[model samples]
Target: MQIEPMATATEPTRKIVQRDPARTRARILKAAIAEFSAKGYSGARTVQIATRAKSNIRMLYHYFGGKDALYVRVLEEVLLRLRAAELQLDFESMEPTDGILKMFDFIDTHFGARPELRRLLAFENMNQARHLNRSAVIRDAASPVLGHIANLLRRGEQAGVFRPGIDALHLYTAMVSLAYYSRAHAPTLSRIFGTDLLCHQWQADHHAQSHQMLLGFLSRPTTA
Candidate 1:
């Protein structure tokens, strides 16, 4: 004797909307990189980034908190990307010379191909590292790469292929300096030398020279 009520005529049907937070966050991050790189941290606007991302500013704030926080996230992201790429080097398992050569080639290839990375690094330096200092994530991200370099140097020294007394971090810095400087100063260097270092042949030449220089540096005997 129980009666069940059917749908009422005046009742409204409910519709559900699904939101993809990961995709939205990625879009925001991508847009933020372009805006931050082009304008530097201070000049980049959340609204502009949102517009570029085809998102709204509220979502940006909701996702990242604020401009400084977003910049920190961008730095964290860029550093993480660099760390990830660096981690792909199997230098630790290879012969020392081969490892060094591979490391150099990898650096050159990465920098030459990824201009956005260069721009983001340039922006970071432009701010005197204000935003980078805000992120512990970046520092942690750098640790493994640095450790890899140290291990490589130690192995090279042990195997008698590389000289002792060279600090791993220092050598790593040297390698980065040599690799990064080319792309970082390409415009001016190209203008000054009247040659496009960005071109394949030129970069190939530079890459060979870099490998030679690093090998020579590693080959020198340690003083007693």
Candidate 2:
């Protein structure tokens, strides 16, 4: 008995457990986003995503089903991040002109901060939005943004600050396109122009120019 007691170890055996399903799912989604953004859907690998998440391919499949499904979820996650942030802004309560500028600023800042989103959009466009089209979540989330812009335009019109017949879709598209192009094509544009568009000074100038262009458009009287 004394000899047996002398051989005993003090440490207890450790057991691995899936303690946090939500956290694991979020990590997988985040890893998927990074992988898809960098490699595009066609080039991205589930094994890479799993490794990035510090998880296994089996776990990734368990959480997201597979690569195509994971890519769609990544798209949904990135888009929803912007949509969720928009809901936090009280654009309706602000003066229309102020709201418009604020919205532009938010978008400019967001695009600057989330270059991955631009890459994702570019990749999706190349795919002709095959995955994006599959997502009703993305479709549903997009509507409210157009509605918000429409509301802002209506308020601005009532206040005589914005021109009539300014379509929300057109306005929204213009704003996003300008912001997207500047950063997305920064390397090429900068090389072509011989100036660094990615630099803070240039970006600031672009932001100001964009503000002026949009506000000027809104201020112009429409031709009958």
Candidate 3:
């Protein structure tokens, strides 16, 4: 007689509990930033973002609508993060000159520390700010800092410390470019000069230099 195989007990399949929508959205955004920062907007994939987020593509769409929308949202979120840090500076509490100089120093720390934020900015710049241009929220987020810079300049002018008729936006743009230049061009600069701008000492020294240059420009007398 042939022996029959013994019957096996089948185990019940475990059901995945649905994560809260808010949590899932946050996770997707976090994962998308990593994905976008690593691959840039044009190269990022929704499926890979979902995989990195530990969710499904369906869920990613459910949270952010689509890839383009998600990419735009990623840019918004990164700018919002940077703006939030800037908003914490309390520029009004300090002396105008000190505040302006501190802002430059803060940029050194903020931009140097937040490499992903810088990468996103660089990527967005490469795209000619097309994605960044799509959001009104960015304007709102940026307005406060520009306003603070304007206020700082006005106060300096009133106190006869800063030069008269200085355009706040121009000065603000100059400060950013000066503060951002080293980190933005670090690889090329380091190769050329045989010095690493990424080093802490170099960053600190450059921060001082930026602070000095910006302060000097702001305080210099206007010649007709």
lDDT by residue (4-94, candidate 3, tens digit) is 9987978899999865999899999999999999889989999999999899999998879999899999989977887888889988888
Clashes of each: 0, 0, 0
- Error (Å) of candidate 2 at residue 30 is 1.3
Candidate 1 regions exceeding 4 Å error are 1-16, 222-224
Give the per-residue lDDT of model 2 (tens digit) for 174-221. Answer: 988878899999989899999999999999999999999998999957
- Ranking according to lDDT, highest score first: 2, 3, 1
lDDT of 1 by residue, 1-224 (tens): 89888866876768887889999999999999889878888788999999999989999999999889998888787768768988987775698778777777777777777777788889888779887887888887888887887788888888888888888778778888887888889899999999997888887888888888998899957669
Top-lDDT structure, candidate number: 2
Error of 2 at 210 (Å): 0.6
Looking at model 3, how many pairs of residues clash? 0
How far out, in Å, is residue 91 in model 2? 1.8
How accurate locally, in lDDT, is each candidate?
0.84, 0.89, 0.86
Candidate 1, which ten residues in sequence have the lowest lDDT sum?
103-112
lDDT of 2 at 143: 92
Quantify how close model 1 is to the true structure by its C-alpha RMSD in Å: 4.8
